[model samples]
Target chain A: MKQRLSTLMAAAVMTAAFAVQAQQPMKKAPPPAKAAAPAKAKDGITAEFEKFREVLEEDNPAELFEAKGEDIWKHKKGPDGASMAQCDLGLGAGVVKGAYVQMPRYFADVGQVMDAERRIVHCMVKYLGYKEEDIRKQPFSNDSKTPDHVSVITYVAAQSRNMKIAVPQKHPKEIETFRIGREIFDYRAGPYDFSCATCHGSDGMRIRTQDLPNLRKPAEAIRAYQGWPGYRMTGGFMLTQQWRMNDCFRQQRFPEPAYLSDSITALLTYMTATANGQVYKGPGIKR
Target chain B: MTAMKTTILCAATLACGAALAEEVRDYRAEAIAMMKRDFKTRGIATADRVHEDGLQAICNRTSDHPPKAIAERLERDQMESIKYPPDGKLMGDWKAGEKLAQSGRGMTWSDKAGVPGGGNCYNCHQIGPQETSFGTIGPSLYQFGKLRGNTPDVQKYAYGKIYNAKAFNLCSAMPRFGHAGALTESQIKDLVALLLDPQSPVNSK
Candidate 1:
């Protein structure tokens, strides 16, 4: 009778252990929908910066890209003849809105971390069977040209506009990725021996009249991260954060970071977490 | 009794998780290694360019605010590295200098080697009065010669500062145009003249 009791206890404990292991991969419950933060007195918003925000709100050029992106997201064309309607964007299949802020998070199936753009490209390749090389060639848009990748990112980011950033760091990989990103931010290299930290690590530092955001802190991180997928008034292009990272590397005199590579995704993960809880106010306009 | 035991077991598991969370994960070394794997050499931009020199490493390590004594020592070393022109003429044509200040084209990966690089002064300073668009990274040099008299010492100071800004302030964000070999001695002399020459728009009304 004692032996029977021991066997029954063992079976119950094993079931409990399995349950805990299974729960690890389950997504966190979606938080209550947050209202956009009231625009506090635009302290430090330069006259030009403020002017750009005020004037461009109604007729923001990013809308054009978003429209194009929506079309491409639904269109079927690649080898598999599959539309990206069911791309799993951390919030189950085909559900688009409010998912952007949580991305650059771990995707278990891919066995890697992926940002919004990287995930989009993965869906493109996996579902549509498009060549990675062909897709990456013109990831950005020009004055007269709109590329699928650039427009799609803008569209996805807009869906999450004003949502609170909530990139998860529950997984061990996610925790380690944040450390990896911190180091990358400070890593100094190149002919100029410049790092991203050189320009951005310090507060009150300006490149020109433009104020540099010190991304180490949460407040500044939110301000900087939320402003991308922006329409550049000067460049006349809808630029995403990935393009911004690429350009910064170029200016630092470092060689180009591979497209959608782990390094870039890690950097994104770090920024996304740093930007947590801030209402995204992008599809923004920039000088 | 079994329910109580299971509850205690769960509590113990939670404690183990808390302990594991306490483990520190430092990313500095891994990030450095990742860059080594990720960066590819293209054009004039080589892989070795990532290696920080002694001075750069110092500024980086200290967060651009080195100790006063160390900064002074390093500034002195930087000052010693400057090679004055053989003829002892520090001033060059303000016209050429003004042109050089206006252009910011140089040292980019796509830029051809052996080509003359710009002073890029306008990108960081207000030089010519006619050019309303200017970057404010460095202080305004409008009336530079007018504010500080254009004496021989002043001429030498401007020349030296343009050649190696780190020699003056050890961690100034201004690039070492001369030290980095991005600009020639003649180009730097022209920049000095642009700032110190009374005839230049920087000093003129």
Candidate 2:
């Protein structure tokens, strides 16, 4: 009788184990079921993009701008007879490599945090002695063949290609700046009452043919953060991060953001830090 | 009898008048003439911009949606115009791609010739989360690789999209970066990495 009881107890224990295993959620979901095969000619959106890729393989006009920017980088300018070579981009003075990947850092000399465009503008004014108005007033070139400051920024950004983004977040100021940036990111206002999160902050969203990235996610943050200072196809110009931000304000119908204002710098720090460890790729091309 | 004859004559006259009004006029020519007469060419915006290419003409005529067969044929023609890298390399540094995506400069009337242009991706896309300010013309690309997976096929798709958006959609609002010579091969490659590289922020943990 005792032996019989032991067998029954063992069976009950085995049943309990099976029930527990069944109740637990699987670590990963099964792969999606295959549906009716799509046409080979219509490989969804992927095939379409492949066609676009083939076209871009030819000569790019941005190369000319990059070449010109290189010249400007090494060229002597300003009343001080100094070149941007002496300018520091948070990686020490005269260092252009990988500087673009990490930006909006704190600088004691500047006494405040600054982004790439603001830093460049400061260098131009303080180091080069170019009038701020002159630099700001110089309109973008009309011709497709001209190079400008935007190109210079692009060239510089390209130098840091493939490097990891490491925007410092250890400083108190950096932390404060990031907090403010977060507020701005989530702040909802404007005619449409739109916030940055309205368009982003979610997954599987799209506008027309383009996909929207969820900025809250680290992977998306890095991919989006690193590709600034790019060449634009619509406006037919190269633009810096500052200009991009400024335009965003305009679209939102908000007052123009002060060029390189602490708000802007803080935003940059927040983005760069959020994107931590992602490879940098800038001086990119955009539609 | 005289009253009926007069009524028939009036009806014939009205038909002839309607036929005359129905004749199609060359509105394009007239518009061109008006533009040439009234519009002044400035520093960089030349009068030639008024002219449309064959594709543009078709798009204009069809209002962005043409017959499927015609669109396919035109797309094929457009594909013919694409230029691949000589070395067949299509990937560049994602770091560089990031900077390019952020910039919005170049090709303004005030700009000089021979300068580079900005991609202005943010004008249409929401790429990075840190950019509190961005546009909504294109879709956001925050976690492209996390959802899509970083495969060679995905990389190729991204490269192509950056190079020529139209190749994928006949009426895509996204500009044809490569088809129009706006972006270099290396630049496109870098952008590819920005979207597809596992180490890229798009795929980061």
Candidate 3:
């Protein structure tokens, strides 16, 4: 009890100190024209990042997807004349704005919980009159081809940008999904015996230089979760949460979870639920 | 300010909620149900792997921290699980070790079963000075032998540690390369030499 009390006090003090330190200005640097050694030149990368955000915010590359996504969203195609405008994303049909943040919600029509991509697949099949096989054939995008689904989801997700994350847990099934998701988050399997918890279950845990988020923490989980469906500069393409989970499973030495798999849905349910109060701040940029 | 207030209010309500009480009581059973419903077997990776082993279950429950007595006991069990080479030799060619260390492949759904896998050491440790791109998850092995000379005991220690890291310390994030069969005994020996042999670049440079 005494040890626990001291630890609690220490944590409170540290939190206060961090809050104070965060408000202080980053160390001023000399002009980049005469920069020092690459390692020592930057005091805080925050200022450098600030510059990137200032310049890049004007013409976000995601705009390409958003533009293309909007086109794909309204266009009548997919073997029959139809548009995704009729598809309901848990906020009723044609309601794109703020819908993404409210998602992984129980859809009464489908009687299941779904993320943006799943809803998109449902819309493509139902309203757009495309087969699940044809739609799943190219859910992702590559340089050679921009899959209609990838851009469409990006546009839909962007509508909820800067909105509060409000994923519903009121439905009994939604609650059950959250419970199941937490389990999958902790489930350890694969050649390396890694669960998501192996890297993401703790604070200060990192793989290489990339700091893993402790998904159990709301603040960290929200910050991390909202930053996905990112524009991967390395791959030079947009990615959805499904792709992110798939790649992570690949890294875990686990089998591929088929596109829009239940495991991925459950994991997203757990993750986004942890992000309940964070402002949606993505289709983001990635290193 | 609104977000903070909302969070505090929710936390306060949840702190007194019966749901929170239920979660505390039934987290494990819920986890088992989740794995059964969601996980699927493919190739060498099976659904049963989602179910944690006894030691891993403890690690999961405690977030990789068990109480000292239980941890020590579990560590001993893990140590006992290690199967050293039949020849009792704990060193192999560091050249082969270096190649294995660099390649981060194998044991995934795509990897063929029984094929030798990479050590993937460089993914979490800096082994040789020549390799500039290396991970910082583990301590550097650059000059590992130069710092800690490779005696027979040291060689065996390296071999054993790589074989079953939890044997040395309970709840080590490092995988049990040999115990999990991700690497063979001979492969572990190669890795042992990669870290402990004088001629290895990890020591020479």
Candidate 4:
């Protein structure tokens, strides 16, 4: 299963948390029997992880990346001596406010539709004169390292906090992208024959103790929409929708999708559109 | 009715059928093309994994609920492909099965090619009394052997089910451990014991 590793890691983290707090025999330790626990303490374990998430949410490190992103956004340091401040994020030249919610839109200039991260990386290569290959080589933040553009996307997402999701479907290409995205969402392949829909298509389902949000339903879809470009507690760095999608494919045992590729944008468009009308709670923190 | 009136009625019915067929767009063809274009092979995760088999095509298109006739046909094909253990034994050590059930390892990009993968059963099913952290995606198997009586027929069914769950249920969420070459014949026999051995925690209180 895609979540099997995460399930084990979640159990270890919770165990360590309780171990530190109590400083004695583990209250939740297994009985004299040598068998491992599965569903007996499920509710208690979920609540513990939930409580830890709330505690970390209060002191999110995403703000640090956001502030760094703002500096890069305003400063001029490209081949043309240009700044991202002038890079239009679909609103006009340099309108960052509420732009994140309305993106993955038709950009007539590029002749393609792009999500928030894709558009930001495009500006980096186009306006800043950064090589496209160089950017894609190390797009995601790992360990203590956070890339400048990832921070930039985080900065843009923060600007649209509490804003409504409104990914556009006006252009024919935009509509077509959304349709392809919906198809990919349900497409099954690989050794396990799993799709994104396998875990997320149903309601009130879970793998181990982790709750799977039904991306097909808007009410549940918001859970998938919000809290992305998030600060990962385990990895301890910022990550965007592109990295998240890439990991989903990895877990599905499929070949790696190219960074900022059209397919990723289409999938993002589908997810963003399905989550339309739900409030984007800005950049989030995750376990 | 006159022959002319009957012909007109048949023509109208055919037109309606055509319209319905046209409305159901074959999005799979275009989507598969997109995947082939955008995805690149890396490590053990190859490009061929993106291509769908006949069974996956049906399950994906129908949302895992293909028509009974089609599902039954495909399931028969799957059943024929299962390679049972040569020794005629269908059960193994329950302790070994317990370890395999708890593990959810192998077959990802990071995994080595020749290494075996875990059954990952607890991730979907509630098995044994001690493991209260089991998933609810599949029905609970808390007392599988106690309920079923562990007959030879039941043991064969359990072994077959684990080897290739799709053969038993055409669109089952469980992986075909043997069919996919993820688990060895001995490993599957062990799993059968986990579900059907009377002395196993799954069967005993």
Candidate 5:
């Protein structure tokens, strides 16, 4: 009886082994070569992105901000009662057309390089004689309406809408700003210890259903950088470029960035320079 | 003899397991204390933000996998904190919602008290088209209405998720916009319209 029991146990063990072998076949053939090389090949996630892009080709509501911004640009404002027509954006004075596309450039007068947003703030304060605190205090929108800052940025950016990003890098200060911005980009800290590169440096990375553009790549950088001062669907408010940078600092667990601060301008200069050839598409609509 | 050996082995194993569990508990406590000591409260960022609530404590202790019974109970508790709009309307103006999502202002140490805060949604999700400077922390919300349809159930889900993301997923990184008072009911409603309104750009082709 003992021998019979032992034989039965051996048979059971053999059956279990066979079941395991059947369940997990050894060395399954690789997927087709053509299938592997598809544009959405990171993990079959890109297939859905094609549909998203198709939807994005339609009209964006951020066009409204751009239109309003244009109006603000020509309208006389401030205690000086002057328009921003004479303000220089590194492309000569009062040249609205395509000026924004070449910003965050070296400015000899300011003795430093500045981004589009910082330059606008400078013009608003210095040339326009508008109080800096008043502009800063202005709500993103006036009770759900688009704000003046966003309108101005959109209008200015729209002037360079189809132009190539041409941020100047001739000055030594410009170079220094780029280097500092690069360091900040790679620096890691906070509860998650995440760096900007964690999401943006790698190609084909994503979070949930959104595709992360690799900021290191020129095309991606331009595609990513050109759209700012966008209208957001989730909050029902328009945002300025300064607000965008401030939020980025918040997510990084760093101290909140001062609006239109030098550090933020330097970072913007670096990013804009990196995207030197991409078409500008401002005051974008976003979900 | 065999019975006696088995009993001895069982006792030894139980003693070792108990010792290991106690060590782990002590280590966790030390880590929490260290974090509290190092964290500095500034402006809106208070020391209490670092302290875990009961639900968070459970998630931390179990590494996001509390016992099934405990998870269910915690979810129920969290649901109770959600406050619905008094007017019973789940959606408001999409145009207003667009502005709120775009603005990323207020609620920092530097910000003055009584100043309104921004939703900062573009930092994570793609809610609409035309936004060139959006981050990809959350999913693309473009065509949300067209894809999900503007049903009452869908509206409720969107509102609830925005209100307290943790209520749906215990460890969700999405901020509790409504529950935390980061957004008002009217703001949430506008956001809902931005996502679900057929005429909104989100639902447009």
Candidate 6:
């Protein structure tokens, strides 16, 4: 009882601090002309941002969620009284090593290609007896709270650190899913006529100093794959690739995709397959 | 006998063409169907946003580079849609334009309806040198007025370009601010002044 109370109190204080930081605008820096070194590939600001990220990565808060997720994965508290230890993640039951890097793959039992988060949610629904709709109600974490599944995903992703991305292409369905994902990436609509391609289809593009990776290219595609299931510093929330895709649609001025839907899975398959053979650098810290 | 042989050859070629066409999967149609099934309209974002316009369909089909004749024809249609501000004034306050260029707000599911949208010019272009964090997706617009003399033609071009960038170049990465009902005519005029006004910081050394 005492431990729970202290944990709750710590969470409250952290949420307050995050709220304050969220409202504060980004600090303005001096013009680049004064600090401009002899022209290099990267500008001064991007270089500075990179150095800052390296410093932050040393003490990433995603570890907090990973610990919490590990706890949830072990405990058997659901209505079905089953732990997620036996959940099959495309590598047979009870197996977790390097599972994340090969996912968005065909699961014969479910007969659908499920990404890491989607398969995690599926396990939660099938083995743990949680209602899918209830889980979907607030799948993403916010300033005040982080979902259990989000933490689980963080924990799962950490297991695949330093592993090569090898999203499967053996299944005919897997190939079709990847093809559909590419089509979705290029499909343009909405108010701006913006597809994923509009911002990310080409190389050497930016949307205000922020580099937009061309996902079609393997070298740049790793930028999208790596550092996901990240701790976003601005909101102090642990987020997953699922949340990222949902937010992308929102920013694209399009309707929200149904949580853990096939479209998101297909999109992940496309991106992950393109990034095959690249190393994933575990849970990342985001600015 | 020669006529009969020619008829048989045509039939075989037609059969081969039909077989090749059938083998190709219509992944675009499947993707659209999946989106229709999986996406739910929320707030200001509606289901109709998934449906592509005719020009958008062409751009997607051709990878943003449609044929020359077709592109020119559609570009003219886009040009004819530009609505210049009343009172014969194409320039507004450059100060307002600067603010709009810096902002990246309005027009999402979260934004309230009827609020003014930002031009978001700096998100993809360098305008005033003071803001060093400008993007490189589009060409730099620094000294837009200094390089091009601020003639009536220049002012009109700036206004029209912001109003509907597709009018100038089809398949441009730049959005059509006015044509899409995103920015008001008055807002586009301010952006014009920001580009062409001599007193604006964009023109100043």
For A206-233, candidate 2 gives per-residue lDDT tens digits of 5423456777777988756644665444
Model 4 misplacement above 4 A: A1-28, A31-46, B1-25
In candidate 4 chain B, what residue range of length 10 has the lowest lDDT sum?
B16-25
True contacts kept of 5: 0.04
How well is each residue in A23-106 modelled by candidate 6, as lDDT tens digits?
Answer: 566555666543222222344545654675676565567877887887888775677577787799988786788999999899
lDDT of 4 by residue, A223-278 (tens): 87789889776556788989899988988878899898888888888888888899
Give model 2's docking category: incorrect
Q: Candidate 1 - CAPRI tier?
A: incorrect
For every model shown, the clashing-pair count is 2, 73, 0, 10, 21, 0
- The model with the greater lDDT, 4 or 6, is 6
**Is candidate 2 or 5 superior in DockQ?**
5
Candidate 6, which segments miss by more than 4 Å at Cα?
A: A1-23, A30-52, B1-22
Residue lDDT tens for model 3, A122-233:
8877877767887667767665666767888889888888889999999987887788788778766555767887778776644533456788998888855665666644
lDDT of each: 0.74, 0.60, 0.73, 0.82, 0.65, 0.83
Q: Fraction of native Cα contacts kept in each candidate?
A: 0.42, 0.01, 0.34, 0.67, 0.04, 0.68
Q: Model 5: what TM-score?
A: 0.50
Model 4 residue B147 CA deviation (Å) reads 0.9
- The sequence of per-residue lDDT tens digits that candidate 1 reaches over residues B1-205 is 5445555565768565554444333366677677777766667766666666778777866777899999999999999999889999988889899888977767767667899878777665766665544565677787789899899999989988888888999877777888888888898888888888888777765
Q: Which stretches of candidate 5 lie above 4 Å from their native place?
A: A1-59, A139-145, B1-205
Off by over 4 Å in 3: A1-61, A77-83, A142-144, B1-27, B41-48, B67-73, B112-115, B130-132, B140-143
| Model 1 stretches astray by more than 4 angstroms | A1-56, A59-61, A75-86, A232-237, B1-26, B67-73, B126-132
For model 3, state the Cα shift of residue B29 in Å: 3.6
Chain A: TM-score in each model? 0.79, 0.76, 0.79, 0.85, 0.75, 0.87
lDDT of 5 by residue, A1-287 (tens): 45644553453344344334434522323534221121222323234323432454244455555656767778757676776887898878888788887888788997987888778877877766767888767635633566566677777877776677888787877776775666455443333233455567667755533577888788888755745766554443467666776666565444544566666665676677888877775556433
| Candidate maximizing lDDT | 6
lDDT of residue A273 for candidate 1: 93
